[model samples]
Target: MSQPRTMKSTAKKTTAKKASTAKKTSTGKKTSTAKRTSTAKKTSTAKRTSTAKKATAKRTTASKRAAKQTMASTTGTRATRTQATRAAAVEGAAAVPLPDFLASAGTLTLGQRKLLVDQALLILDQNYVHLPLKAAMHAVNPLQRLRVMRARMERQTAETMEPEWMFHRQMSSIFHSVRDLHTNYLLPVPFAGKIAFLPFMIEKCYDGAGEEHYLITRTVTGYSAPQFGPGAEVTHWNGTPIARAVALNGAQFAGSNDAANLARGLESLTLRPLVIQSPPDEDWVNLTYIGLDGSTQELREQWKVTTNLPPMTDLDAVSETSASMGLDLDSDEKARAKKALYVRDVVELEDGQSSAELKTPAAVGGADLPTTMPGVFRAREAVTPSGTFGHLRIFTFSVQDPVAFRDEFVRLAGLLPQRGLIVDVRDNGGGHIYASEFTLQTLTPRYISPEPVQFISTSLNLRICRRHKDNPAGIDLGPWFDSLDLATETGAAYSAAKPITPEDGANDIGQTYHGPVVLITDARVYSATDIFAAGFADHEIGTILGVDDNTGAGGANVWTHGLLAALLNEPPPPDSTSPYEALPNGANMRVSIRRTLRVGQLSGTPVEDLGIRPHETHKMTQADLLEGNVDLLAKAGSLLAAMPHRSLGVTTSFSGTTLTVTLNVEGIDRVDLYLDNRPISSEDLTGAPLSIDILEVTPGQSLRADGYKAGALVASRRRTV
Candidate 1:
């Protein structure tokens, strides 16, 4: 009863109409009452189910809220723990003590120290991005301190560490064992955008002083083939395709193998390498390769070698066939053929000519016919017996002495019909400076203006000795002046105007010849040739002729002993290493004992790119040489003949003890009044019919006019008073 009262199910009952109850006695009415009782029971059960569903919904909502809070608290705790752990790790790393070995060593070997510093710096760069400012600063402080310490140590011990000794020590360490040297030190050449490596290992040892030391050496015996990355293409000068193979083993170490032997080894490997090809216009291609010592080996191999390429066995036949079929030859083939042909032509001409005929020619048929002679001569063929001039002359300095060139020049000049010369220096290359000086003195005029001409110091060796400690005497006033006089019979103070040294004390002055000279030059003319050109120009000796337009004013300070000295001190890095390898003390010192410049004399000027130009330009053409047209040399001689005589007019006047001569001229600037054919003074005309004190004039007392306009002598006339 209590449960029924408490269960106010709140079910709304449906009421039937009272009027329908009047027929309640029927059968249908009796069934309807029974159904109503069953229906009411079902309705009560449905109401209980609805109430239970509401209660379960409330419990689910409350449980979900509590679970979310619990998860949030757990996640927060985990994050806090992770952060603290990371902080502790960082702090521990920062406080870690330096290794006792590193501290006790005081100073590391140059190579070892550099490697360590470079590795540390690389780590710092990568981690700095994520670290806080304080942490980054803390990391950098130790690295900077180490660098300073190393630098100071290097300076103090540099003198004691000979590069040769260091190299030997390094080599010993590398070959100690193969397994220990598996890790190679890779060096990057940023300029070349290439990478290289050395197989190295460290060994502990004691020095002669019984001091503990470590030696680092390379493992490889001789040389290592450069390992190229994937995506690299191999090509030759002609852009020929090449195939490549990865080395099964790293490069082998062969102690100081010559280039030829190395090439043979590479060929045996069947690596299919391509070599630089020769231009069709050249005799040979100068192939260069990395040597065992990491230096460039240029043309050191006696025979050319290329792997897996079709041999050029039938090249000559192919070229011949192509020529017959009127097909164009390849660039490389054409160059080789052209050079061979040129050499043949030059040899043929040289064999056919005689020395005397090439220099001077006898007037034939009284018509001044073209000279037809042979052999090497300084004079133009038109002025000599030969009507033609040779293209070039090469002296190796082995056969011809330096002093002899000047003596030969003087003798040849006197032999020529007229002093019209073409000094061909196109193939002269270079030799001793003394040789160049000798040649220059012979070509220069006997009389020089008192004004100081420019002098060049091409070598640092000379500059240091002359300008620095070696000679306390002024730089310009040294043995160099005496060297200049070696080619001449005249003393240092000898002059055409007045001989300062008495004739009794000095050798007889050499005969002076006034002539027209032309200097022919090309790019091959370097070093001593350059010095000769400058000296000639300064002294107004001759006109320079060539396509090269500028002189090498900047001197190449190269000494004969430069390479030798470097070897004695540095002894090129062992045959297995590069010359640029760091010393044991970590010092990256480069030796540039020898230096070169385009302009040897002028400091600011660069002549390497700008070549010296000729007064009259002529190119070396196959057609011209074949036709035997020596027009360039002919033109040079004709120019000299066209020049007017030096003497024009000379008149004498007497004023007290003074005697003077007035010279008349039309196209002349100033005249040299030579008393009795001896030059008196340049620009001597002070006044018209001017008088000069007789005491100053030479005793011969013959007045002559030596007038010049531009580069040519206008006229010459003489009178006796």
Candidate 2:
């Protein structure tokens, strides 16, 4: 969403009219007259010319001088034109030619065809001048095409056009390939810098007739690290001595009779040590020696100590390296412990179904009540029949469930005493669009006066060319080479487009409690809330209240790519050897798509960055809420209550999971409540030491304790454990 405030306002009506009329008049008379006069003079001169013998002599003398001048001028003009033409020709030739591969292909697979078309469309849309052919090829591949294309496009369109795009792309590609290798290759390759091949086995397939078995094998490789004791002693593994070694090597595996058998064989030979110690600790060495199986033929072989271990680094060097890797020694240790606990808890949760029951002490009073109203509350002070004034109801939308937004709205509206209403959507974050639409429909009267919304049209360009042996005829490929068509425009245009006007339906306002309505909004209102605001502004059905400021105007929709590179490349600060480390690799992008135009007299005003500006503006601060200042809400309620001949009343009750408060007034209405001059929800009243519904009481007077006890108790009160 564009910031509504920053949007350029349309020219004033008077100025627009003057400019339009002036342009039309200027183009219509003077220009037409000038063109007609020029044509007339040329025709008159041609008619006057004649040929005769006596005039031949005079004509010859004049023709000779004229011919000489004409020849000189023509020669000069020809040379200039030739140079210009050649320059244009050279530019045309220098332009990037169409890809030879695409030109040669008669037909293509679905994937190939989609790739080509998408690439072409993207190029056309972006007008990229220096896209490399190799990069384009990579973008059209089946597995990686979409991801590559999106990345490339984002980089190309970035505001800065930073030179880091190539580097990022290459790094991302390498990381992706490495991840795939890890996932696909099941063989336990040593981290000793050796590339080891492990064979994969496929087992059995089931069919209705019987089970079928198949055998297959695949190899995988990677480098592996070594483990050693603190005293530079080799750890004992099985019966053989464990030596630290690093190498770059590859291997091949033979297929087995059955996939299961092959898998078992591979598992038997593979050695995957969880803890690889550098200069192995004494305890680690002892454990390794004890775990060794002397009976095993493979382990019984003697160990060869051909090469000595490399010299260990100093403590300072190790510390420096660890810091550069972004590891925190203390935090890493804590994280490892937490990970173990987390795994244990997850396992327990998964296995112990009965353990899910955790007993919690219930509270007395209204602590556990489900009748808590979940909607924005406003405070409005109103005068009663007895001349006493207090806070009253103004407007509220009960949004308990996103899907039931419309239903809640309808219920609230029906409960209102008067048809005239004011809806406060300030601070509303977005939810479901359907709910917003439903709310809008309910507010709209049955009868609608037809009006034109706007006009929508699109133009597409088509390219047609024919090659020639010499100079081919080149047509403009840009602009509208095809056709243009008009489509339905919404709002005013819808009414304008219709020819037959039907009799208006009975006004729902009369049937219901239709009265003057106002919509209040602020910057925090977004998404579905914004949509509702837009509808209200467009219909001219109500007055808007509040400042024109929207926080979400600049960011309507966003895209996020998760942490991968940050974890693998840019590790956390204070590097350590611990495997557990915090990784923060969150990135996001946001873009605005649609443009919003307020309707009625405000049609030219945008509600994108600049929020819907209300007819009346009021700013609410945090201090107001904390201190129990109800001035803003009270003002709104007073305005609504002042509407003529309106009876004001409020009904409070428990409705399943929510507390329902129906405040009705003959005209516009407002409601506000405060506890100890501090604002609180109805739910907060249940167990509070002091709570009062200021809306139902006289100004500066608190509700009596008896009234709180008499009200229906929906649930027991909650107390801190």
Candidate 3:
């Protein structure tokens, strides 16, 4: 089994994102990352000093796990773990009273509560780019909801005001009503950072008869749900049927559609992102299920809170969240939790030992990849029942360098089996808008048409564009300014839709993987991933296979109050015109300020709420969950088998401004050659290895070739001199 290394999460140039926050914001400038300061940094230090201090006092569940591991390492014995397991069985794995903390901590005074509400309202009303679109699409008006909540709060006395739990829930729900994850009411400190979870995960799989069954697919090591482990079918959750419970739980989340809601709702059962969620109303859940031995089992699982999470410093979290973000709010924490379960606890690398119980199935065992960044890309040859083909799992596009990111992908695709390929972006939540768009051309054989972005026409929106038109470090909203300026007279609802990802960058690395490609996506695929999927479908880049009906549909660029604050208050005295103010008690807020529109034939369509639908859909089967997407791969394989096979490879050799282009082709009747996207020459091939040499082709210019199958274009390849 190949062990794919998970990069230690950080945003530093070295820490990862923040360190190399090259997540080019609107200005296309790489961000200077935030430090994980033991001591406060001067920027927003006074505002965050108390937050840093408050966070230290709590033991997030992961921290507790780490602490126990420290003790076990000191003892260096199996007995310590054995004792810990025993303790877990008697009480619960990392279980504690969550109500006590939520009920006590993060309680804001009435005046502070109203102030927070007002500021959030101001941001949403003034700058939220999706306001008009969301108003038309969803039933709940977020602005109206907030105002209603504020009105209710105004009449309450100190003793009668709703508890902290209700306050957070109400605030979170207003954002949820919009059904856009990018727009969220992040709870204050302790609650904001902690994640609530059960030890084991329950997944829904369809049996042979097409009946749905909930099974315990994974668990924290040593801690099973009582005597039951994987393969146990859960019958009930808190007295309600498990399936129905999932539906109810999912409604509280901000999933864009029913399919997304169900997926998210199911996940909420085991892992809840407290950053965007209130603590589970109940401290513990009574679960009843049928065990593997055909015996019925019942157990009480306590919800555990863990602070062992990814660092979400206000600016860093919000900056990345907005720019590279279509980011599922809880993606960082979810990634950390998943790593703990599958990588940290189960896989032992230092000793070079294997645990067969948890070993990955060979079909899903990623091939040994030699890339510097191993976490983002997973390469494997999937031997599905239909056939064996190259499987490239793009774990994320949320990386620091789009160039390095796409270059590595091109390299990996070249190394894999060239017959057919499965490009899996299942849970990718998106990062770096440019990275996602830049990556599109690598998969298809055409000049990628990037999805365009538009701002809701608002006076504040226009002002923001004007403020940063000259600042190169941040958003240079020059392109949209003229239209926005004209909107006042025209009474336009939105600024002109334009591609944020440059067309040159989008087509820069055109069609690296020429094999008939099938992209696999789930509801978790959002933001940047959404853009990628839309582009894939719009550009006719082979088939799309979905595990759910649609993608997460989070098609907007979000800005945290922090990112907005930085933009408006740059270089010297703060801009008095800026509407942002620090929230009370380290609370934060986010809103999608730019909405994305689909391109190509689906032109002018908003990607939000209406995400890309797949060409084919597969239901999750028992084999899929237990055996590394076996069924899903089979579906992808079958699709790849039927798709047309065509290949085009461009190799360039330049001699003194004269460029020689060599084409290695199959299934192509004729080929067209282009120099820097301009048509230079053409060839009608008859069983020939065609060569096109063009004069006056300068160094550093791009050479491209397109293959035609009987007059219709079929394949393309691009290369730089």
**Predicted structure with the largest TM-score when compared to the true one:** 3
Error of 2 at 629 (Å): 5.9
**Local distance difference test scores for all models:** 0.30, 0.26, 0.69
| Residues 1-721, model 3: lDDT tens digits | 1111222212212100101111111101111122222111101101111242232222123234433443344346334434543433233223355666565575688888888889889888988887777788776687888888889988998888887777888888788888888888888877765667776778888877878888777665446333366666788998899999999988878588998898889888888767777778887788877765555667776666654333323334323223445556665456545544444422122111111111121222334554444556678788877778898887666554455566667877888878899999987877667767877887777678778888889988887778766654445677789899999999998999877776655654567777889999999888888988998899888899998889988898777787777666764466887777778887888888788998889899889989999989998987777667888899899998888888776777878878888777877888888876788888888756777778887787767778898899788876778
Report the candidate with higher lDDT, 2 versus 3.
3
Instruction: Provide the lDDT at 65 for model 2.
Output: 49
For model 1, the stretches where C-alpha displacement exceeds 4 angstroms are: 1-401, 446-511, 547-554, 562-611, 627-631, 634-721
On the 0 to 100 scale, the lDDT of residue 425 in model 1 is 62
Better of 1 and 2 by lDDT: 1
Q: Report the candidate with higher lDDT, 1 versus 3.
A: 3
- Per-residue lDDT over 1-721 for candidate 1, one digit per residue giving the tens place of the 0 to 100 score: 0000111112222111111101111000000000111111111011111243343343334334433542354345444534543443233222111121112222444555455434433322221111122233223243354456446546644455444323322322232111111111111211011101111111222223543222221121222222111111122211121111111111231111122122222222211111111101221222222222223223311111111101111111111111011000111121122111212221122221111122233322232222322222223244323333222232211111232334455555555543355666653334333345445544443332211121122222222223322222211123333333332453332111211111211111222334456677653344345545654555566677763343322112112111212222232232342122232332221111111222223432322223344565554332122223244455555545554322234557675546766565444566776665566577744324433344455344666555566755544444555
The TM-score obtained by model 2 is 0.28
lDDT value, candidate 2, whole model: 0.26
**Which residue runs of candidate 3 sit more than 4 Å off their true CA positions?**
1-104, 225-227, 311-324, 345-370, 650-662, 676-680, 691-701
What order do you get sorting by TM-score, best first?
3, 1, 2
TM-scores, all models, native as reference: 0.33, 0.28, 0.82
lDDT, candidate 1, at 478: 37
| Stretches of model 2 off by over 4 angstroms after superposition | 1-403, 416-422, 441-518, 547-594, 603-606, 621-623, 627-629, 645-721
